[model samples]
Target chain A: MATQTTDVGQAVGGAAKVGMPQLDFSTFSNQIFWLIITLVVIYFILSRIALPRIGGALADRAGTITNDLAEAEDLKSQALAAEEAYEKALADARAEAQNINVLMRAEIQGQLDEELAKADAQISGRTKEAAAELAEIRNAAKANVKVVAKAVAKEIVAALGGKADAKTVTAAVTERMKG
Target chain B: MATETHGEAEAGLVFHPMDQFQVTPLFGAGPVEWFTITNATLWMGLSILVIFVILVLGARGRALVPTRSQSIAELAYGFIYKMVEDVTGKDGVAYFPYIMTLFMFIVVANFLGLLPMAFTTTSHIAVTAVMAMAVFLAVTVLGFVKNGFGFLSVFWISSAPLILRPILALIEVISYFVRPVSHSIRLAGNMMAGHAVIKVFAAFAPLVLISTGIGLVVTPLSILAITAIYALEVLVSFIQAYVFAILTCVYLRDALHPHH
Candidate 1:
């Protein structure tokens, strides 16, 4: 077995040195050439193929982040506008309420003034009518008293039976009454 | 004698036929021999082709909801992106392609090496050294392009207190030059050591009957170790690639901003 193994080893070693076909370049040169080739090939693959995809992915990520941020900003602005509108509506409602209050107060005051004026005029007319009725009653009372006094006086004179000339008697009574 | 028996004992073990793949010089070649493709190169090429085809096909549809292939592609992309971002910050996105490619290629190569009867291209010092040199050159060029001569300020310890300037500057320059050597050696040594250990451990399985049984037990253990090491290699591959890329970025940064 040992002899067989040695024989196989020797044969293999011999074949490697002489019997095998050779190539153009030295092992070192071949390695260098292959290394260069590998480098160029790799450089080509990377620059042409892989990098562009990675760059695109990175750009897409950046763009997505930027878009999301912009959208958030837009939404914030819209919210602010909506809030402002809500406040304006509230203020308008308040202003409208105040205006309605002022108008209502003015209307109530005007109606009150109108009623007061009407009452004042009625009171003045009633006072004037009461004064005129009192004056008429006083005049009628004076007239009645004067009629009764005159009739009584005439009856007395007839009962006393004193004869006199009409014109002289009338003149003497009027002069006595004047004195 | 005992040595001969020991040698015989050592020789009784078997390995897969393809395990014989090795880097050997051509017969009658001079010190600088003619260049030729080895099994390692073939495997490396196949691995590269496989990775490229898979990625290309996976990315074909490029749908919104990813297909399975697209998902795999996207996952790889995302993983590398996160890695870059973690290492170099968001600005590293500019370098995403280069870093990702480096990571994928290294990972696939390491994974391929884990297969039985497969060649580990990364185990070769020449291969790893060249890769490290390429990184070094690219970074150096980037530095110059970005900052001109001002990039040399990274090695200038005079930027600190004048008393320690010479020593510190020497140390910095030495460390800087050593980067490529260390980077290459770290990867290549790890791969070579691990695979050699596995081969040696496997060779021990046929010595004694009890040892053979022990070998059977330990063989699976060694396989498990190999798998673990392979996984570790995968991690190291990514880490080394990342380190290379990030250091390049750092060097570039220094070039771009000298005071930093």
Candidate 2:
């Protein structure tokens, strides 16, 4: 079938009769001519346009990757620093709370001590006043007892029908109390 | 492709494997003039168009995150660039575009030729020879320019004993001159041989229709063989292009550093 299609062109000269078409020198010039044109065209396309564009693209990609990696590294370091600052702030807040607790406890203790001292002084003063009152009552009772004794004696004497002087009776009662 | 070969199905098994490689005009049954737009021109032109599409238009989107075709373009560029740099060293990076041109052309052309009934342009000696010769001449001239008369030291073996140096030099000189020949023939031969072998196996595919007994075994075997060979050919296509480019770099290296 290939021969049938290509068979149409064998009607030229007797020199076309050859075992291999590759050895056919007649087509060399045509092949070489076209080949040169093709090579030159390809060369220009590659050198002037295609290769440089590809190289540029590859280089551009590499540069972009490098820049991105560097930026990522910078962000990572920044995050670490921020974490350190946060930890320090937390520790500072805890220390401040501790200081406030100690100060508040000391201030409360001072107020309690002052209140207790005032109550103790009031109790002692009241006790002394009560003791004085008690002593006065005892003295009054003792005087009353003597007077009653003298009155009873006078009544007895009157009942016996011997009317005597009050002065003398009082003197006698005083002497009995002394003895 | 199966339909294309079916035309000769009725005429019994006919094997014209070499006919696929013939260089004929795409238009009429006329002479293949130097300027004539033959099948060779069609395929070569197609190769150029493909290169333009893949390397130029395909990679139009220069995205930081690449699209499919854009990545393909970058992959090809890096592959060739690395090859040239590895084989020819840093100074050879200047000629990266030229080496890239050859690599892209051959690689794409070879793959295009893998299509059924498609003309394999790299299968021709004329085409591969021209490319190899271009590399050879360029390297030779660069050697002379860069190293002056010291370029001849490439063939001279300094490490060898003085008694054996002449013999080593003689061998090196022959091998140096043979670079272009081996380089061109190797690519063309691999391509031509693979395609011809496939065609031969394809011719045997219709054996089942002719005779049932032997055709059962021969037909299936040939088809399987075709599959296997086609797979191998695909590998060969890329490898051949790689071999060509690497060889070119090796030559360039020798030219640049002509010593040990």
| Tens-digit per-residue lDDT, A52-122, candidate 1 | 76545545656778999999999999999999999999999999999999999999999999999999999
Worst ten-residue run, lDDT, model 2 chain B? B1-10
> Per-residue lDDT of B11-44 in model 1, one digit per residue for the tens?
5556442243354433432322324444655666
CA lDDT, candidate 1, residue B155:
79
Clashing pairs for predicted structure model 2, backbone only: none
DockQ of each: 0.09, 0.40
- Poorest 10 consecutive residues by lDDT, candidate 1 chain A: A16-25
> TM-score of each model's B chain?
0.76, 0.95
**RMSD for each model, in Å, please?**
8.5, 5.2
Candidate with the greatest lDDT versus the true structure:
2
CAPRI classification of candidate 1: incorrect
lDDT of each: 0.64, 0.88
